[model samples]
Target: MNLRMKIATGAIALVSAGLMTFLGTWEGNGQNVVYADNLARGLPTVCKGVTKHTSPVPVVVGEYWSDARCAEVEKLVVQKGQLTLADCLTNQQISQNTFDALSSHAHNVGTANTCASRAVGLINAGRIADGCRALAWAPDGKPVWAYVTDAQGRKVFVPGLYNRRRAEAEMCLK
Candidate 1:
């Protein structure tokens, strides 16, 4: 190659390498399936209608899902969660772990709720530690009251939500 063309090629290579390094440094790897698994662990499949904690809407009987079906739902949930994070976060760059945690949180609480939550606000404000803490308290800030009134007038906490929040918080901190 000519001297000028060689220099230009070398410059392009350097730029590409730098860009790849920069992207690698930021832990934004797409781990949607992992996040969905975390969510599924938190929200187990049930064969009957049940009320999800802190959510006014009840999970209808027909909505109960498991196995592949559950995975499909979780996939959709993670997608929504990602969109919610994109919409809510303005300046903060998030890692794969952070995305997984937040996606799971959004799946449980909902995209709108997660976007409007204190966690998102804190994250946007550059208070990542505080944001993780807020994510831990995602159950409407009530970790102790693991149960809410179901459609049958029964007060019972949805299984695994508290533990799920804790896991999400830990993931965020990582």
Candidate 2:
């Protein structure tokens, strides 16, 4: 079946491997314990970037999760993110690469924000390349979703996030 059909029928049974690879490359292997996400205002995260906001399991600071547990949580999180992306992109046909790229972006920045962003809007409007570009930068030349609050409460651009977004954008173009 085609991407649109699978999305429309909710028949995409599993998260795409590309998304798993993307998350692994960006979020790193499950830390095996919760650590403060410095980029997210010190949000406690574990297991391939699973945080309180995103994890199916409860997340506690300093809590340990074995590799098996981390893999479970990561799978669940990625599946959930895929559902969110599918919902947001309803009726829109996209490549698996595009879906994986957007899923990773949504997983990082929050699905709600991603769904409402110019990227989604552009994609829904059939401007696939424009949407991909929006993942890296806004039309105003500002980095999109690449800033994090520093300890001093100043917004600082994170090169890692910028690079990730650029990579995701490039993936979508492939």
Candidate 3:
């Protein structure tokens, strides 16, 4: 097979796997009394719950959004600004200038031990970006930017997910 064909085959496999796992998780988690919707999206890591805060936490991070966290970001954007105040936080430093930098920096990695605390730590320690790229990414295993409609069907303009999803692909059309 040619290089392009090989790469295309690999991507189809990844999307299939991700979609299957996502579907199964939705089926498993959806039956609960809480989740408002099923068929929700999954990120690179579907970490277990975050450990309790131990203090001196520079910032909290996680691999995937709690179904609730997704909803909260959605609510704030609709009520307040394009991006929520919480969206501005990053391990690098919390400053007005940092917001734009955040999206350029984030990339997701799937972890069995997923959790918000770990996610934040990865973001802070710079592991999230480094580790994701370090993984055995095929030409296709990059993350996709989702419209991320929330419970109210509003789009949360999360810059990090947007950029990472785009950058992970061919990187640039040019």
lDDT of each: 0.50, 0.83, 0.30
Question: Which prediction has the highest lDDT against the true structure?
Answer: 2
Estimate the TM-score of every prediction: 0.53, 0.90, 0.22
TM-score of 2: 0.90
lDDT of 1 by residue, 56-174 (tens): 33444335344454334434444444554555666435555665566556655666878888887887788877788787665366663234565566777655656666767887788
Clashing residue pairs found in predicted model 2: none
Of the candidates shown, which would achieve the greatest TM-score relative to the real structure?
2
Which pairs, if any, clash in model 3?
44-110, 47-114, 48-114, 60-120, 61-116, 61-119, 61-120, 62-119, 62-120
TM for candidate 1 is: 0.53
What's the CA error at residue 32 for candidate 1, in Å? 20
Candidate 2: tens digits of C-alpha lDDT, residues 110-160: 889889989989998899999999999899978888888788879898899
Evaluated at residue 143, the lDDT of candidate 2 is 85
Candidate ranking under lDDT, highest first, comes to 2, 1, 3
lDDT of 3 by residue, 1-174 (tens): 422233245421212233223323322332212222222332111221111121111113333455565334323322222122133334433222122122122212222122232333444465545423322232366433334566687876555444543443212111
Show where candidate 1 strays beyond 4 Å: 1-73, 138-147, 151-159
